[model samples]
Target: MQITASTVSLTVADVAASQAFLTAHLGYTVQAAADGFASLTRADAVDIVLLARGTQVLPPEQRDRHAAGLILAFTLADGLHDQEKRLREAGVEITMPLREEPWGERLFQITDPNGVIIQFVEWATSDDT
Candidate 1:
């Protein structure tokens, strides 16, 4: 089968908080929303669906589980530093500082109000590393 698009569904205590954080800080647009659910989209990133804990859309056993121990990462072609600076200027707390790995990967992270970890990454060429 072929896939047309991708989305990550996160269960949070407050759907609105995650929705607002993504839209205000990460450039996501609301595709749809309701009392306990929100669908967000961005042109250059994976779509996100936030569901409040206890939402019936989830299986009975999973409805109480919240998103944790997961890092939603987006890879960028360039401008990693600029993005970090922009977020900083916007008053977003950087949970992980920008750092380059020996393998030539540069990345940083921020935790949304709902405690979801979002990471932005860029790869350096051999010459630059």
Candidate 2:
């Protein structure tokens, strides 16, 4: 299969709230939006689709489920600290403070209004392979 892009669709209690948070703090722009849905995009990151909870487009069994216990993570080539600082300056609360692991992974996390966890990560070494 040929994949041109990737997207994460999140079932949220408030689509507009998530949309606003992503657009204002995470550099995403609204590609499209309606009463209960929004498609957000950024040039260098995965597209995000926010769907209201209980959206009928999902299968009946899944329609009632909301995004939980999931962490949407972005791995950056560098500037992890700078990104964290920017987010902090924007009044985003850091759920996980910046820390480095023994495996050379530096990371932090934040929770959006809908309780979706987002993580930013960077490698201490160049060998991401």
Candidate 3:
């Protein structure tokens, strides 16, 4: 089977809060929204669906569960440092400062208002490693 698109649905305490964070900081556009739900999209990123905690649309067993211990990581084609600087300059807290791993991975992280961890990564070249 082939996947046409990708989306990540997150159950957040406050849908509006997480929606605002994704739109304002991550360049996501609101595709749709309702009292307790929001759909966000970006050309170069995965689509996002924000659902209010306890929303009935979710199965009973999953309704109360929140997005935790999950890191939504995006690998950038380039300019990882520049993106980090831009986010920092925009008053977005850098939860994890930019650092390079021994395995040639350069990455950083930030936590949204709903406590969703978003990570940006870039791979280093042999010369840079």
In model 3, how large is the Cα lDDT of residue 46?
96
> Which parts of model 2 have CA positions greater than 4 angstroms off?
126-129
* TM-score list, all predictions: 0.97, 0.94, 0.96
Model 3, residue 21: C-alpha shift (Å): 0.9
Report how far off residue 36 is in candidate 3 (Å): 1.0
Q: Give per-residue CA lDDT, model 1, range 1-129, as digits (tens).
A: 999889999999999999999999999999999999999999888999999999887999999999999999999999999999999999999999999998888999999998999999999997784
Q: Determine the backbone clash count of candidate 1.
A: 0
lDDT of 1: 0.95
Cα lDDT tens digits for candidate 2, 64-121 = 7889989999999899999999999999999999999988889999999999999999
Candidate 3, clashing residue pairs? none
Q: Point out the higher-scoring one by TM-score: 2 or 3.
A: 3
lDDT, candidate 2, residue 1?
Answer: 95
Candidate 3 lDDT by residue in tens digits, 1-129: 999989999999999999999999899999999999999999998999999999999999999999998999999989999999999999999999999998899999999999999999999998774
Lowest lDDT sum, 10 consecutive residues, model 3, at: 120-129
Off by over 4 Å in 3: none
